[model samples]
Target chain A: MRVNRPKDGDPISVALNAQERHVTFDASRGAEAPPELVQLLTPEGERVEHPAYDIDLTPEEVRGLYRDLVLVRRVDMEAVALQRQGELGIWASLLGQEAAQIGSGRALTDADMAFPTYREHGVAWCRGVDPVNLLGLFRGVNHGGWDPAEHNFHLYTIVIGSQTLHAVGYAMGIQRDGADAATIVYFGDGATSQGDVNESFIWASVFNAPVVFFCQNNQWAISEPLEKQSRIPLYRRASGFGFPGIRVDGNDVFACLAVTRQALKNAREGQGPTLIEAFTYRMGAHTTSDDPTRYRVAGELEAWKLKDPIERVKAYMFKNQLADQDFFDSIEAEAADLGRDVRKRCLEMPDPHPLEIFEHVYSEPHALLTEEREQYAAYLASFEGGER
Target chain B: MTTLTLAKAINEGLRTAMEDDSKVLIMGEDVGKLGGVFRVTDGLQKDFGESRVIDTPLAESGIIGTAIGLALRGYRPVCEIQFDGFVFPAADQIITQLAKMPLRSLGKIKLPVVVRIPCGGGIGAVEHHSESPEAYFTHTGGLRVVACSNPVDGYHMIQQAIRCDDPVIFFEPKRRYWDKAEVERGAAPLAFDRAQIVRPGTDVTVLTYGPMVKTCLEAAAAVEQDGRSLEVIDLRSLNPLDTEMVFESVRRTGRCVVAHEAPVFSGLGAELAARITEACFYSLEAPVLRAGGFSTPYPPSRLEDHYLPDLDRVLDAVDRTFAF
Candidate 1:
């Protein structure tokens, strides 16, 4: 007798088959056509409504966000110019991702902490880190110039996706302390594929730790596009880890602020991790050393220019009559001063002493470290005109 | 004075450290409700509460990565890797992040993290469970590596490692966990970096640490019966090497044999032999002989005894030095 067997898909097989389907942003349909994005404002500086996230910013607060965007851009431009002038070894310019960084960075309370990647200059501005202090890393003077604990922002982690785990752990610590603090971690779309990031998702979900994963999906991770990293939307990947995921218009400052504020609120209120995919584009090369022209088309950049993160905020400020020409002129003058000040400070940055390399290998005195220091000192003295 | 096994001593040490400081924590896989695979963290969770003794998911990298974060939050974290072989998954966090974080931050942050790994072979356990991966950590600059061969050392070394500001890789010999000795619980903590001569002699110097310390001690006893007095030095710290003690012992004996459970090629033995030869060239009775496992993956339980350095193997290397 032939037994009838039901042909049903197992959860694992179904998930794997679904993952095989390709997910990409269709340039032909344009950036505005992407579905399920919780956008509070459009590229044309028009206000929109979202059922989940909403914000009512005062005229003064709106102007402050605009100033932040413009000055962050100015600092980024100065860093790029400094790199070109050989004042810095390299600079990771956050040209188009300003709103994504500032919005999320500004949403945090004093109790909240942030773990950032190396390309978070805008977030550093929001965190009150001096722009010149950031130049020390790119200028090869120090790994990170300022104290991370003082600013509640950790030092920049260069190894991609590693900081996410640290953020979850810190969040766990907050839970242990019975505090209402939340933790936010910044990474790019490329970091989604990293094991540490995925592990962080699992740890946060299982522990129900308060954390917000803010990923700036800037369309390009170095040379690889979003298509190369994921077959599904990066936010959708969060659902598999048993958490809510949201996408926002990274170019719209209003949308970013509203979404991040809600996410941080949810985290502080004992909600587990939330993944916010800031759908933006990298408007410049990956870094000062990268040549994006070799990999991307100029037309793509032209298309994204209509959705400039800083320009939209500026348009909103002008359309709403929040500031007059005097306000604009003062901001421009302030930006110019900032640029000149950063350049001067970057050039005046003193080189660290050669022996400083052995200063902090260990917090305690190690016999091996002492021996190596002595050996290195002797070797340096052996050089012509070199002294120990 | 009370007698305690090495495993129990370590547990007591952890309990004491946690009692001393409210900021100290213990986190790892199976460390909580399950107590731990070897029961080294037994009853810790019941006493300290789940927040202090955490039972993490079965992810080695996550355990270490989070420990670094907790350390940054001004907490002293002691992480336990279930076995020696499982430490590889967390190598990036340990070697790249935990090890170099202080130096990378230029001393702006201090990571007081202790990664406790139960290493070496002797028990008929599965393959990955028994390995001596200390050399990989010792070679890394920003990490402090130490091992415990006996109960008293285990008791003090663990607390010392937790109190140290630097990241320390504390290797506990799993095979000797059950071995007991009388310990003075109120005695001052021993310096975690120095080597100690457990059994002194004048004819030959046998250098070993962790699990192999007992094997070398047995070999020393056997060689004494054969009218050969053998000096045994337990190298408590692998990174620092305790070169002064090693050099002094070798200078007195004029013959040396380094034994360990790890493979001979590029192992801790190789570094000790090279440094000893360079320092005591004129004091050499024979080229420094090494008794250790073959340069291969840790074999199956059936073949581990053959691969591991035992009493016979140590004596054979000692005899070879005499032949030279």
Candidate 2:
């Protein structure tokens, strides 16, 4: 069942023969019984069988997924770089959140609805939403450029914990419609403190809504570490709300994939919502405006680098003879191409026409919008006549 | 069909919405068994069961925050803030979260949640209970705010608020909750966010809403007896105001007076004055006068009569507008 665990005979072993890779394996075990942390794949390349959880992913599928992860990370990097270069006004980097997002996002069926915070570019990518369109929002060209129905992805909600409630409500709607699809909501550690998030927990638990609250607790919510927000573990907080929660290694794609699948299935099967605290690290600054160096040290960043999500998968591939050097090289090349395309597309995005603001405000037109749009157009026209 | 008080109308509205849609849930302190402190949600839990009409803890933020979740789950949630003053605790959810959700979502999601707050001063109650905070929600985009001044509106508006695709802050004038009227319970509902001109005239446009609608109507009648024609406009929809109606009236009368129980500083009066001035600049012959509560906290019940902008105060503002 193991898909991406490292091997004993890989270059990684030769490079670090004296020391073993530092992974907290025992931490994966928890008090709960049945739905144990669904991990078919281990961090090492050695394949191991899991009695409860297993996956029958093919070689081509494995290669294809590796490519997706690489491309997604590259897009994330390009967006971050664009933000730093002032091409984007702001960016919420998904630097360390790639595996958790990609794993959970790929698990969703086409009919499933996704509710995301500002940092779900990886999930959006999995949903086939053009990443360039997401940049239009931060670039001040438009608010949100993608339609939710088109991609089954809700717009990025910025007010911390607000989207969780909306997700629960949407789930309630799904239940009323007698639909089998589940709703997945994404949020950060900081959002857990919000009244809305807590309330979402209450509603989801009481109503038995078909929702999976995927909390990517990347340890820090804008310089405030996890300890500042909660005294107990974040996953344990779900128990108080009458639901099961699990802590998974967010950096491990296999762990994230397996756990998220179980959680989503649990919801769709009418068992109610499950809270997933993807325990990981924020490998980059919170956003373009953030200076992580001011709050954290380089050593902390280096420490997480050893547990790199993509590197472990690469190691597993190399050790298991899943792919050759040429295959890995081609994937890297594809990632580079994705990076270049993201930059080019982001630059070419047109500033939304002023009239677009008045559109989609309501499905039906109103007298006020018409009058205001007319007045605004007149005001803009007057500016054109006066200014150089 | 049924003659009911505004309170009873609201109670029936909750009952009907819950009956029509199981997803339509009601949550607030005492909303379950006690039917709310004002009994506006009375007998709902008994009919629909505790699952639909829930009695939540005494946390305004908790009530609203969870309501947002319920709405997200495809449940049309109607949340009650125990009192006008108690809404402040959950103001962050209302102002920052609920107000901007639809726009932030780029219209991908519609928040059909209704926040019902019993507002305005007249019952000689505490300070926070009487304050009119509609301007705050009105200023916030992605939120529709409306106030019901009478039993008819109280009934129809509650149903309309529930049916709206957008989130609505339904402000029930606490003073007028007990006001009885021969309400047509089965009448067709009005538009979601449009103002209703309760009393029309050609002399001047008297813009008012909430409990002050009665005061403005009384003032308009008194001024008519004094040989001065006056138009009283009941602004049911505070946000997305019925500026067209006000503008049309001002264009004819060349004068205006705005009234509310809230303080005048940056209040609904200010909004009306600015919009009227912009839309009817050349038509206006005099300054827009405002009759509202004084620049002070809602005083004791003994001083409430003076604190609330009554018929005399509104007429004085009308006189001042004519003087201008």
> DockQ winner among the candidates?
1
Model 1 agreement with the true structure over A78-194: per-residue lDDT tens digits: 999999989999999899999999888889887899999999999889989999999998999988858888898888899888899899988988888888789999999999989
Which segments of candidate 1 are over 4 A away from where they belong?
A: A1-34, A382-385
Candidate 2 chain A — worst ten consecutive residues by lDDT sum? A20-29
List CA RMSD, all candidates. Answer: 4.1, 9.7
> Each prediction's Cα lDDT score?
0.90, 0.82
TM-scores for chain B, listed for all candidates:
0.99, 0.97
**In terms of docking quality, how is candidate 2 classified?**
acceptable
Indicate which candidate wins on lDDT.
Answer: 1
What TM value does the first chain of each candidate achieve?
Answer: 0.91, 0.87
The deviation in Å at residue A7 for candidate 1 is 22
Q: For candidate 2, report its TM-score.
A: 0.87
Query: Mind giving the per-residue lDDT tens digits that candidate 2 earns over A43-107?
Result: 56445566765666778877866777888889888988998798999998899788888888988
